[model samples]
Target chain A: MVRVTELTNLAVDLVDVHKTYRKTVQALRGVNVQVRRGEIFGLLGPNGAGKSTLVKIMMTVVRPDKLVGTILGRPLGNRKKLALIGYLPENHRFPPYLTGEELLDYYGALAKVPKAMRRRRAAELLEWVAMSKWAKTCVGEYSKGMMQRLGLVQALLNDPQLLVLDEPTDGLDPAGRRAVRELLLRLRSEGKTIFLNSHLLSELEMVCDRVSILVNGLVARQGTLRELTEHTVEYRITTTGDLAAVKEAVERCGARIDNTVIILNGHNVAKVNELIDLLRGKGVLIESVVPHRFSLEEVFMETLGTAR
Target chain B: MQFCALIVDSLRHALDRKLFWILVAITVLVTLMMLSIGFEGGKVSLFFGLVEAEVDSYDPLAASGKARLVGVVIYGLMDFFLGWVGITLVIIATAGLFPAMMESGVIDVVLSKPISRPVLFLYKYLASMVFVLIQAVLFVGFTFLVMGLRWGVWVPGYLLCIPLLVLLFSYVYCVSVLVAVLTRSTLAVILISLGAWVVFSGVRQAPAIFDTFPELQKHHVTHQVVRAVSWIPPKTADVTYLAAKWSNAGTSLDIIPASAMEDVSAAERGQLERSNQWEKEQLEISAFSSIGSSLLFEVFVVLLAMWKFTRMDF
Candidate 1:
């Protein structure tokens, strides 16, 4: 197990964390990863890939058999440090008797926030989540989307240093998802580190500055979005006029020709330039040059499939 | 402050469940029934579907070993409600506390907070006790007031039932908590608690029943086994008897006649004598030995639960 002392910029730096459930299933196996400060870090994994378990260990909701590292500059499982963290567990269920405002207050109180501030934060978050009108409505009466919004509000009650969200937009409409993306961006700009575990590849791709893909209890890849997608870069060149000339020019330069279109593969920047120069030299009117990179979903599927 | 919030959270959870209100309503209704029984001069008037016709009533002021039959009957019913019916309601109401809290999503959010697991577990335990405590206070407090206003005697000892009822319920609640932690099933908790209570009560009657049939040597062995079983589950009956004894109410229930033991063997007779003395002393001594022994068992069970809880992954 790797143990690092407090590093200020590291919001969550966990190393060699392992957990074996009931002495039978090893949910997490020597997983090591770090989430940088002031960045939205998305953790992508398939189901039963130990995403929630890893987060639970960081939150101290679950104890790992072998865990070493720090969260928010404190040792893993530090109780007081939790007050600085805002967590939204997956599929959370709130007390039915409590209204939206009351539920916020309850979570706020658990963080040991004082009376006036709890109410103030509750009001602020309710409005921020567009739940101000339903503040007094019972949680049980609220729809799933409403509850997800309220869950987001409850997570922000403490104004935490690190916001750990598991499937934060699990039950949201398209507009709600867009709103959450905006909200997360706003929170990010406020200098809060977000550790997000989400199955929505597109959502994560849009919001996450960096991402770690976990495959079968291991960190398969972890880096900035640029780093993960850089290798999958490809280029598509379109030309007009003579297709025979375009194909002849593109084929000579080792590019695939499909009708009037020439497909350039890989991060071979020089090859791309060679093809562009060759097309122009052939006097074929160039139409379009499109650089294509793998989407987060494609990367995820490829990573998972390769791991299997 | 967080601890208080956790307790409030638990209270809020209980408030959400229908059982809590049902138990509260029962306590209130029972308290009202206690208030309806009246004794004036030498006549007793009972309301609540009981005897409405005037009957002879005993005076507490008299210098005799006699209690107003109406007062005794009311007190008996009071004990019965708070002891048996109230306990059942409490067990059912709070049985789901642990299981509900320990549910996957629920436990994660709560336990991930800045609180220790043991302290959190203990707060939950105290929270369950609060349900019984509030109901007991209301039930005992209202009945005490009625006993004073109607019977014209203020037995502060009656107020002892509040704590006694809490202690009695704690005994069962402790078992319910242990079972809940182990099974995480509200129905399982309730069923096991009810089963344990029934077994304890059945075991308690062993000595009395053995004294009734001392002629059978097998009765002696059966009585011994039952008495041993009594030491396992918390002596809830012993707590009830202790409350009655403290309030200067019905003493030990002596069923078999002394002459009935004469035909038995000397050893069997000796066992009968010792058992009788133990029961009498059990009530008079505040049922301390039985309750103490039983409380130890509850503590052990709770410790087992806490140990398992702290060791659990989630």
Candidate 2:
């Protein structure tokens, strides 16, 4: 539950967002997402799961059928407030006739950045993205990765408070992806909220402070990394003595018995101790105990399965 | 500043198209052709005096002769060439602008900017006219210079063609934008706008066509409907008369001189007389009424396009 008094602290607070395409395909259904200021929030889902649609609604690129929320303490689609926001849409195409520098200047002008500031930022961002040499090259001549780098520069031109990027690493090499990850961290450190929509679970696991998993036009799960993956932790105890002697007893203790291990499915320490004592009574020597938590990929798969 | 940026972007985009340069080349060629024709005293010389013909009434030293020369630039160059052919090519060249802007990736980034959709749409629509504006200035400027330096006749009123050309393009472009917004298809925009230009031209000329033919004028209901419907679409046909009137190029009789009419038979002279009368009546059409009504129609169409643009999902 969120208090009304905390709305100012949220960079994005969306409630009951719904969208239908062509009156047949329902893209989003009652999506509610919140991103706190200065935090990195990730939105992950499979293809056609309304992740892009939700992002588009926030950016005002797509009109929602019914949306009730505020962004950056103001209502959605507020033009003045949008100056404080920057967006890089997936598969974005810049005007090919313009050079990279000119493209940035054009978009910066549209973003309402002053002329002097636009030029300064364009130089800094191009260099920061390792694209200084390609600044004068027309976008039509650029590679996909180069275009993606320029897109990042354009997105950062206004120095927005809330940066929204969809598939920011869609067409990059390992070095480029790492650079983007580092850039996101740098932006976060500057107290700018970041909303990242991506399908790369590991990437989100590496950076996102909290994430919501969208499944079939609805949020299936929403929480921090620990909150989502910790519940499925399993404790595996390896023993020296054969586990056939205590198989039935181990099953009765709510543990599964392997040939040389007892697999405990929960975080109950007392239950594990009781199982160990029973094993010791049966003369089984415990070698090692290892606890394992599910990865984000596993958690995502499980959420998808459960949602289905 | 946002609108200026959009205009610059649009100009750069237009510059990249081959058709733009091709039009520029054509303008240069036409200007060169005009430069090659020289007038000395009462004689007209082609190819810079390589071929000369005597004409008593067309001497460049006289006021009437100078007016006729200015009439050549105003009626022949501005009206016939720039008004019809140039506008058609511009419509073809710029028809893709709105549809291209609405392409998925392109529109996504633009709409995300701080500007509202209507403002963006209106700005882009205005920016797209930079192509016509540049062409008109170059064509008229070059011809104005040729008349001043070569023929020794300077008509400053001829400069009005620049804004008048842009206004005419906007009248048709409003419809093009409406169609582009409704259907994001360049081909549809081109076909429909060209077809609409024809329809507008036909409707504009229907009254004159009826007046010229006594039989058509006899149908009272049809004549009244044609006259009423003509007020709705852009007055494209009126632009020629307006250009002639503003430039002070005089009537067809004054421009043609009495010598040219001497060879005509009585029947042909009567026909020419009625044609000249119609031209006089067209010249009498009020500039405010024509331009104001056309602008009203453009505003309505543009508002309709903006309404659809703001409501669209892209």
Candidate 3:
């Protein structure tokens, strides 16, 4: 039997959560995920892969047909637990007639922040999002990137324990994306759990401590990047001497040498050491050795396959 | 606090709309026009010459009462027009209120907060009602001022009708909201609401038409028929012949004697018994039923809107 106590301390735990729209389109097909506290967990998927649907279900914007989940150690859609979660939807829009400050204040009030604190936090968030200069400007005139920044600011207004962001960086520039990345990292460091749905694999690789790859409305693979991508060890060796000898030495150590590259399949670090030792003993002067880490994108493609 | 935010936001939104300003301008212009027309008192002729026929159906006794009735009819027309305008505006305004927010993905941000759905819906409904009340008061108060200026009397009872007018407008507004929840397009909501307006307006007139039908259907022996043949269309000759027969007894075939007509003056004989009291009661009943039914309709519309909104996908 699964230990339920493990989820007692978890930020989010979903067991057999299913959401079917009109009982036809299965947006989420029995998705089960566990996010530990104080980690930036990325939920990566392609278009129509149910990324936004899952985020919406978690945020209670869309109710699931069957949800056996706990958010912030409480049942899903619990009001008290909802207060502990902040959500920024994809392509977030605010009332165009309201100024940036007014929009933030409005959402802050809805989040039940103290009246005194609302003003202070609104100002602070506007500054944090680099929108202090345009705080008085109506959102109707704001650019898409500015809206994204403001969206993030509003999501962080309640100082929530878990921040659920759906494609939060969709319209941001490189600099804006960087700011969001830094913000997420800072929040994680401060012991806040972040659930991010992003299409940018590079951003996810840099920020996410753990990730779940969703394909066809189900979890294809889920683990830390180290756990998922550490299966293969690839080393590029440049040697000055005859490369034929180096190739033979690597092959003898049960390593495959393909075009001056030595690849050790699986976690066989010993073979790498043996190849290195053999090259040295054989008087094969190696110029440099470089190790290539598998990117999250590569791992995602590998696990999900190139069917798309 | 959230409710307050919703109210403030809704007011700000309504204030910013260009349609709202247009409505204000129209109301002001209409009030001024009514004031001018009311001040320039003239005899109201119910029938105008058509097809080279001079038909004058003008009442001269206590012309002020007739003028006041004319003014009241004008006010009713204005109220009906305002209802139409208000319904259109509310439909267009609220059509985007929820669906647009959801389409733009802002609902996720708002709904994910700690606020409950019922609280949010309540605030929105309250905000809409407040908006309707403000517009109704502004329009009706201005019209009252104009009427009081010309008539030299301000009826407080008319002011009491403001709530009824607001309730009527709310019925349309809430029904528009329900359409908004059921449809995805603003144009669809507006079209549906306009269709509803036509139906309700026609329904409200049904009782009056039915009440007058039998009396209007009464046959009469006209003087032309008495001179030539004895047949006249019952629909066309009833009210006129009845009034004439009641005025002069010798004009009919079954005339009592010329001496009977000589006893009473034409004006004295033309007046009907307790006509004013009966007319007042009819007006009161019609007004009461219209206001009560409209208020109940608004409540039902609001409940339906809430149910649909709660179950909607976005």
Candidate 4:
């Protein structure tokens, strides 16, 4: 397990990737995403926002009309470098004919793992995924959640430096989702970079170190969870005073008064202090001040609502 | 190493389908039928009413027919059965291969691997060839044994069937891969490839038919048109015909079709000889020129298919 700190600084640094399919239908438009080492980065977008296409470009599975990127410090599409990256496609369909163990072996061999290592790793992965009992069962017999677990095993087979999972928990049950979330965090802890593409907001909120919201072939918002949600916040101030004086002082201080509460519009601490002083000067005591920050889901909605 | 894995994985892919086992079973059944052929008397006895009465009167097996000629007879029988029927069944079993492998959700997993797209494409094409190989081995191996033990004539030329059948299937499979890449529909690949095969076979034989009838010739130069048409596609039918020629070690002229040799007058026999001479010249391409020409055409189509496949987004 190689930690990102132990390696180079960036796992993925892509710039201005534009993909136009068949001379029409532009799928990606000048998208730039920089993923730090050992971080779980979430890519959230509505359907057809090109999140999968972006990952495909990084994995060298999709040929972009114009591409500028380095994956794991190597130029995109470098065959040797791709061995250091693992990808699980959205709605992935592994060959139904292969047994669970055979599926791992097949992908492990593709990843150029040695025979002994592949055998040992396949067993270890199956056991880790709690799928050892079903190792010999044909994949067609596995449930959707089971397939997702097996897919994750395949993605990890190479002990990749960067793991890209498209809709990783799309078909998983609650427990399965929780397990995958924990597994992703563990991978991050091991210093492996993760690029997760999914539409599930809460899942991303819970696990991702940083996130990017994409809409209409463009990046709508991108930053750490705190960075995205902390700017321009609405502060809730509770006060015990006459409503009219509170409203006048609140209006004078440039904040909206929602009944007894003063809702400050800006994230500026100076304005909050000024408003609190005004309330104190008016002989009204401030009961409490609780800063309200938006959740990632709200940021995602606000980001995509621009497309309307 | 990854290339080998893709090939082995694809073989498993073929084996997973019931179509593969069914084709193997049919090959075994046909081999038994070929083995049931008895020659207790000077007259031939074919079991299960395959040709109970007609095979007896066939001049190819007349008392005057030489023992080496028996190899030619067997060559014709095996070539017509294995070459034509066997190759057709193989195409039916395999035409959907590239399309099925390239199915949307499926192909992404393979394309994402470290292997180069062109290498993967070509290897999977070879993997689809595996389905035919198993049948070819069983069919030719059993037929070789029965031909040697029952007929007492061991023609090593029988070994050419395996490679030749592979070439024939490959010739048509290029079309399958191209269409599968373009459309990703197994039914389309099967219909279009088999349809192209029908057109190629139809064109290859049309010249012979046009040359046979003076009435058809009087309408126009049909054989000339057929020759022009035949020059385009890989000469698949001729590849099979060349396999029959190779089966006889290139020494024997094609035996006249049994129906054409029935009660022939001397004057008509002379005409038959002239016709057979023209036919012999048509089929007399050197083994190198024969297989090589078709293979070059297959290569051209496969290259085009690979180009599209590598550039493809999925």
- Per-model chain B TM-scores are 0.82, 0.92, 0.65, 0.82
Task: Please write out the lDDT profile of model 1 over residues A1-308, one tens digit for every residue.
Answer: 22345546889889899988888898899999899899999999999999998998888888888977888888876777888898999999887788888788877887878889989989888887788999999898999999999988878888888999999999999999999899899989999999999999999999999999998899988999999988877788888876685676677777898877788778898998888787777787889989999998888888899888
- lDDT of each prediction vs. the true structure? 0.80, 0.88, 0.69, 0.79
Candidate 2 lDDT by residue in tens digits, A147-211: 99999889899999999999999999999999999999999999999999998899999999999
Identify the runs in model 4 with alpha carbons over 4 angstroms from their true place.
A1-8, B41-59, B64-73, B206-229, B249-254, B257-271
CAPRI class of candidate 2: high
Pairs with backbone N, CA or C atoms under 3 Å apart (clashes), candidate 3: none
> Cα miss at B38, model 3 (Å)?
7.1
- What lDDT is reached at residue B230 by model 4? 68
Over 4 Å off in model 2, which ranges? Answer: A1-7, B56-63, B252-271
Q: Against the true structure, what is each candidate's TM-score?
A: 0.89, 0.95, 0.81, 0.91
Residues A175-286, candidate 4: write the lDDT tens digits.
8899999999999999999999988899999999999888878888899999999874789989875668567668877898876788887579999998888888778878
Question: Stretches of candidate 3 above 4 Å error?
Answer: A1-7, A243-253, A277-283, A306-308, B34-61, B64-74, B85-95, B149-151, B207-210, B214-282, B286-297
Comparing 1 and 3 by TM-score, which wins? 1
The local lDDT score (0 to 100) that residue B227 gets in candidate 1 is 62
Could you say which candidate leads in lDDT?
A: 2
TM-score of candidate 1 on Cα atoms, chains taken together: 0.89
